[model samples]
Target: MNPLLAGDRDVVISAATASGKTEAAFLPICSRLAEEPAEGIGVLYISPLKALITDQHRRLESLCEHVGLQITPWHGDVPKSLKTKLRRRPRGILLITPESLESLLIHQMGWLKTAFAPLRYIVIDEFHAFIGSERGCQLLSLLTRLGFLLDKEVPRVALSATLGDLVMVGKCLRPAEAGCEPAVIESAALKSSLKIQLRGYLIPDRPHDEDDNPVDTVQNQIVADLFSILRGKSHLVFANSRRWTEYFAAELADRCAVHALPNEFFPHHGNLAKELREQLEARLLEGRLPTTAVCTMTLELGIDIGSVDSVAQVAAPHSVASLRQRLGRSGRRGEAAVLRLFIKEQEVTADSGAADRLRFHTMRCAALISLLLKKWYEPPLTGLNHFSTLVHQVLAVIGQYGGARADQLHRLLCARGPFQETEPAAFAALLRSMGEDELISQTHDGQLVLGVKGENLVGHYSFFSVFKTPEEYRLEAGGKVLGTVPVDGPLLVDQIIIFAGKRWRIESVDDEKKVITLTKAKGGSPPLFLGDPLLVHDRVRQEMFALFESGECPVYFDAVARDHFEEAVSGFREWELADRPWLVSGANLWVFPWLGDRVVNALAILVTEQGFQAGNDDGILEVRNCSEAAFKQAIKTHLAGPRLTKKDLAARLEGSPIEKYDKWVPKSLRQQSQSGHFFDLEGAYQWLERKTDFLR
Candidate 1:
């Protein structure tokens, strides 16, 4: 507090959820502003989600009122009247998202100097959410650009509950600010009991469609368990994706109807209408109803949802950090946190794939939970070039100043901003690519300005977001917006679909306007992907190896899970995985490098480049049309070949890091930037080197 309030250094406060992290950041900021009485926009408070800003508005409204300052929320959904009032005056604290801020930077560039003249501190809430993402890089660039309008360096304050590496976080917070390492403040860990259980279900190994209906005996059992335990409690049931969120909530609601009980379950996610999402949030916060919101990561962050009785995960969490965030939603107010994992595995038989035989899914869950219990989550993603974000920033800089020379653009974005990893030649190449794409053009006087295409892009409201927003068709029922779906293919009339936790019959499909009119549907649904999409860290897979090597059986495992794990352990020992990490059956050779997914994906591509068929099955590397001995010899021979570069590895990938601006970027430049973040060729090389038998 002393350093934050009195000094100019940046600060990062990491603490458990419901432990006053928000207050810790705002208390000092509010005090400093109230005491000094700054003129305009005293604090630049930023959040990752618009819902979070709305929640903060309610929480901080009274405090700002007491301190004789104004607090305003700004976003796309925000009322124009409030935005107009703020624009006219621009005083006190302004809560905004990265997109809206981008909007102001482009649309209202003229008013910013007057509005931000008195800004003192910049606060980023939920700092972990924006640390390593494309949005994170955009936020950093926006802040760096905002710095250009101010007279002095504005100290940044970060608040988070699930940060793994303080050093990495500090570097991200101040990428170009030398000697501006953030002062790390972590709360003392509280001693509490954790009651957890892991239950496993066996899915029948029958033929299934990729987009099949999410209804079966295994799913029903998991929902039945949820209905029995969480019927009359305020808790959060987290699914891996929105599709499963809808499926689980609808199933749980149907069960309540069957028993003549009040429907306490609801689905909450970003796709749902604002009114519907807010209603569920209010019900949970007020505690009037015993509501259990089955949701995606929408309800994962800290939003003052009151005391949750427990947290339930439908499948394996995408990452340890996400698991940590979801778990933090519970175990608050000095109560032991309760957790249940509904791990589902296909019944193992003779024809099971390598992933299922290795029981990779269940072992992944166990390893993640073990890592969480040990207070270790993944560190920030390393080696991100963010070429797409650079493209957005380039256009933004051009628009912010109306026109800028190429050298100035490069200096600000490449030299001084978060995209320092991009080389000068690469940056120059990007500018040329943008010109060819018609995103930007150079004037005769040596100034880069928006072209006709760039003008149309910067003119749209959607241009503010750096992440990819799929083209979605709105689902409307009786003139009310339900949700949206990204149907990549054509949709005909009289189609039955599931969305927003309910079944819907497609009444009409207007391709021109991109809207799907719907009516109340009686039954049936087509489920989407439910498996984890994030890459598994090397430490997690290594920890899974330790779990298999040791003979300790945790008490939290159910009988089914225990049997599944025991079988996996026996198979692991029989296969000699600890020593060899490879297995051969007939024509296939499976190599378990225990390397992270990024490296493994690169390895697959490199192996494919060597004229062999290789791909990643879960975390295992599978090579086709090769015996074990042949595969080993091939890898050794490749290691003795010419050294591979990121460019070479990236050239093989069809698509990587598909951000919004990636399509407009040149192929060579896109590959250069994508490779920095997506493919770890050096790691793949090192793994092959370690595994190759040099003595032979």
Candidate 2:
């Protein structure tokens, strides 16, 4: 509070979840605002989620009630009546999301300076979520513009739980300030007791000796386990995907019915209706109903879902930082944080590879847990161009000013903002491409205006977001709208499918309405949700290799897991995987780089570019129709050659789009965007040089 009141340095408060970091930021900010009242918005609070902004609005309003401070939550959901009031007289702390802020910058440019001129502090909550993302770049650009508008340095405060490299985060928080020193309050040393358990299950090829059927048996066991372990306790069950969240929640509900128990489980994810999500959050927070939410990363943020007794992960931990944040949700009341991990794998068959036979999922899960305990997290990747976001900002700047000169647009976005990574020649090339694609048009006086296509794009509501979201088909059952799922094709009637945790048979498909009508079905498979696989970190992969070599049994493993562990170790030794990283399968040669996903992706692309049909599955690089000698030569050639540019590698990518505006970008620019954002060529090159020495 003293430092903030002094207002000499920016502050970043890093603490564990539920450790009062929000209050730590607001307490000082509100105190200073009280001492020196500002007519305009006092503090601009930005978060990644609208739900979080709304939640913080309630908390901050109460805290600032006596101070005669106004608190307003701004997002898509907020009624226009409330927004109109803000537009007329924006005062006090305004809680907003980045998308809404972008929209405001576009729609209300005339009032931005007036509404934010007296801004004293800017608070960015959940700061880690924005790091290394296009949204983060958008935010930095927005802040740069705001600073230029007000012509003053706003004392910034960032609140986060799982931030690594404070120096990098500080630089990102204030990119406009040269050599900006941030007062960092790190609480990594704050220790909490954690109780974690890893349970493993192997699905049989046929449900003969184990049960009547494999699927039903596994579902019943999972439900029974949930009932026995987490029943009547406020808990969160996190699945890796939305489809799984719905499937598990519905399965749990079905099991409760079979056992004559009340349905205490609910599904929460981004696909669900906002009202349904809010209802579930309200119930969880009220604590009257013993509820458990089978959710995705929606509830992973600091959105006050009340004290969770424990957190259960359905698969391998996404990342050490993610696992740490999820674990922080528990043990908030001074008890040991409880983490229960359930790893499922199919029974090893004659055709199973060494990775499958050795239960790689279990090994990976255990390795991630061990590393997280040791307090090692993945560092942020740097040197991204973020060209897609630059495109969006160009459109936004045009929309904001109605029209602007090309050089002026370049100065506002490229020359003076976070988009400085965009070279001048590249910026000119982008403008020309935009003009060619009818996304922008030039006026007679050499000004840039939104083209017809650009107007049509910026006219839509989704244009405010820089991330790409697929077109979704709404799902309805019993005349109730359950939620939406992204589908790329048509669905026939009477097709049985699983969605939102229940089995449903499609009754009708309204193509024009983009809705699917369904009736309850007895047996069905989970809906196929298309998404990229979770990328494992290099350190975690290395730790997995070490786990195999050490042969130490983790204490958290149950009886079955221990058996699986011993079997995996035996299989690993028999297969000589510990001594040999490469394996021969038929005519194809598989190499285990044992690196992170980005490096593996780069390796696959590089090998494929070199005329070998190469792919990656479960962290192994599979090269086809190539002898060991040719493969070694190819590797040597790549290592000895110059590094591939983003353009060169992107040309070999089969033209896959990575972001929303990527499709609108020129082919050359899109290639650069995809390569720069998604591929770590340098990392892969370095790993190839080191890991291939054994082959030579």
- What is the C-alpha lDDT profile of model 2 across 1-696, one tens digit per residue? 476777767888888888999988888778888889999898899999999988898778888887878888999899999888988888888999988888888887768888998888888999999887888888888887777767887888899998877888788777655698799988865445889898877777653542122253465576678778988888999987887898899988887798899999999999899999999999988889889999999999999888889999987775888988888888777788999988877677765545666787888888888888887777766556778798899998888778899888888787777777788888889888889999999999998999999998888899888876655778898888988876532233444455654557677777458677888765212222113435677888899888888899899999888888888888767767777767666666777777777776778778866777565556667676677778888878876787676677767543334566765666666666656655668888787767676559
Candidate 2: worst-modelled 10 consecutive residues by lDDT? 523-532
Residue pairs with backbone atoms closer than 3 Å in model 1 (clashes):
none
Write down the lDDT that model 2 would get: 0.78
lDDT value, residue 207 of candidate 2: 34
Structural similarity to truth (TM-score) of each candidate:
0.90, 0.87
Off by over 4 Å in 1: 207-216, 470-533
lDDT of 1 by residue, 317-375 (tens): 75888888888888787889888899988777665657787677788888898888898
Which numbered prediction scores highest in lDDT against the true structure?
A: 1
* Alpha-carbon lDDT of model 1: 0.80
Q: Which stretches of candidate 2 lie over 4 Å from their true place?
A: 176-178, 189-191, 206-217, 471-530, 577-579, 625-627, 637-645
Query: Could you give me the TM-score of model 1 versus the true structure?
Result: 0.90
